[model samples]
Target: MSRKKTTRHKAIIDQLSVNPSMRVSELSDALGVTTETIRRDLEELAAQQLINRTYGGALLRQPAEPVLSERHKANVEERAMIGKAAAPLLKGARILMMGSGATTVQVAKRIAFEMNNITVVTHSFGVATALSLNPTIEVVLAPGVYHAGEGAVHGAQTLRFLSDYSVDWAILGASGISPAGPTDALMDAAEVYACMLRQSSRHMIVADHSKFDRMATARFSQWQDIDVLVTDIAPQGPLGQALASGGVDIQLAG
Candidate 1:
């Protein structure tokens, strides 16, 4: 378009890089433009997912893992099938540890409706809320700092509380799973899942095929730490070899 408009777009991105957020008035004043122009700019940037529009301003978007709420809506059928396939493994579980994840939330739904008379210790509020629907299942929430973005808890207190107890199984989900192992997008989340696996007799990872071979921020569990992988598809290539050689059972939900 015009040179002025080109310059304005660059200015908007640059200003956001400096302060990460600004009001329409502030940007308009700085750019020597009308408030309406700034609003239009913001609308354009927001449409590109470059920033999040606020009531009166905007927040610069930082690249990171997808929001938990949005992730719940993705891979719905695959996660549901993985959840259903994981049920037989929990057949006789007494006390268990579950980590926070969209796929784990699906597993929690099954336990809440089908299973009975089991106690679960977890850091995810979503899992707790789901399991709470069943009066017979006791839900123990781990003490920690609540993370609104993840709808879970993670901190020193959570690790300390979990370390004190042993459980029949530790069930978790992963953002990525490669030859190295299962991983999470957040360091705190990775640490929490690792700790849960260590304290349980059997460790199970519930993830869809989308996670296969993808590497995330942190690898939390080695194959030795994982007993079963409940997924929607069979592991292929190096992922398949690693799991087999490492003695980790892969159960395909399909």
Candidate 2:
């Protein structure tokens, strides 16, 4: 490939990383390239399995996760607030289900410190270890294929294991949520979360304000699917009202 072609391809990948989906014409204009050039670049990227070609443009083939160390540092205050907000609701639940995310890890820590005699089921190694230190909590790790960078296990085997047992409540973390629904960057992650939601009687979403209105590559569930949403602050505007009208309880932490 020529220098220009390589540059165009890199630009397309960057755009798709941020937006997930885009039209070829939009990408062409954004990159200051001709439509035919954009099309050729898209074809090459698709061939390499870096992207999936749609009718007009392409979607990123795999959603990327930040390194676990880096992810642990982002949004510290917001995650703590979310964890604090979620802790009270965890009381008296013998079997607690938690999802994998930085915020959810904080929730695990909070649960370990505040609650006792709880059996925690999770795909997050971080959550399992965090709670293990408490000794009061019994951690049940679901078996599956581990994704190293994300530090979470996912796949059909994991889902099947989750289906065998039901939990009193499930606390979930999401990449983004809007009026439309909760979404994840990766489809596999979404699938695992969907299984957790299905197996649990009560569902709660733990997210920060930054997640509001952001879109992701795949959707796991709508706002209605959750019984409660715990965040640092209440969402403002139409999306917040939509969630309220839909009978989803909102919990905001100080």
Candidate 3:
């Protein structure tokens, strides 16, 4: 690719990383290129399995996690407030399990800073590493194939390891949530979360406002399965009403 084309490719991927879906015209306008050029770039990206071409746009591949460096850029304050709110709930718990994602990492940071003598079991390398900074916290990593982009482990081995230990609390994250409940963009991550839910005595999902009403590739659990939800904003609309009626406790950080 020429220098200019390379620059456009980088910009396109960066935009998709943040929004997940975008149209050719949007890319064209954003990149200062013709629609035809943007379409060609989208086709190239799709062929490389970096994105999925749609009718008028492209979306991030279903199984792919956003580059970790970019994940933290989307929702900063909301995630932090959520972490602070969630930390107190696990205050007395001895054994805690954390799932992978930016919000969950924030929770781990709060747990490490505010709590003491906690044992954290997780497949998320980010969670484990963050908690390890506190000597009072013991971090146990579940074994599995590593997904570097996600900074987590997931596979049959990880599931088996998680099944062996029941934690006092499970702090989880999600790619999307609907009235049907929390779903994940990737099946492997969803499967691991299902195990995490089962192997823990209590569990909750920590996500930001953006997750509401979005649908991912797989639904991991029903609304009634998890005990609580921590988010920046209270969900709205009919789906929100349905989730509210479903009996899971909803806690808003903001």
Please name the candidate that would achieve the greatest lDDT relative to the true structure. Answer: 1
Q: Could you give the C-alpha RMSD of every candidate to the true structure, in order shown? A: 12.1, 5.5, 7.4
TM-score of each: 0.75, 0.75, 0.75
Name the lDDT of candidate 2. Answer: 0.83
Model 3, span 79-104: residue lDDT tens: 99999999988768999888999999
Cα lDDT computed for each candidate against the true fold: 0.86, 0.83, 0.84
Which ranking of candidates, highest lDDT first?
1, 3, 2
Cα distance off (Å), candidate 1, residue 186:
0.3
Model 3 alpha-carbon miss at residue 40, Å = 30
lDDT per residue as tens, model 2, 155-251: 9999999999889998888876666677788788889899999989899999897677555667888777789999987876555765887789999
Q: How does residue 173 of candidate 2 score in lDDT?
A: 88
Residue 62 Cα positional deviation in candidate 3, in Å, after optimal superposition: 8.3
Assess the local accuracy of residue 252 in candidate 2 as a C-alpha lDDT between 0 and 100: 88
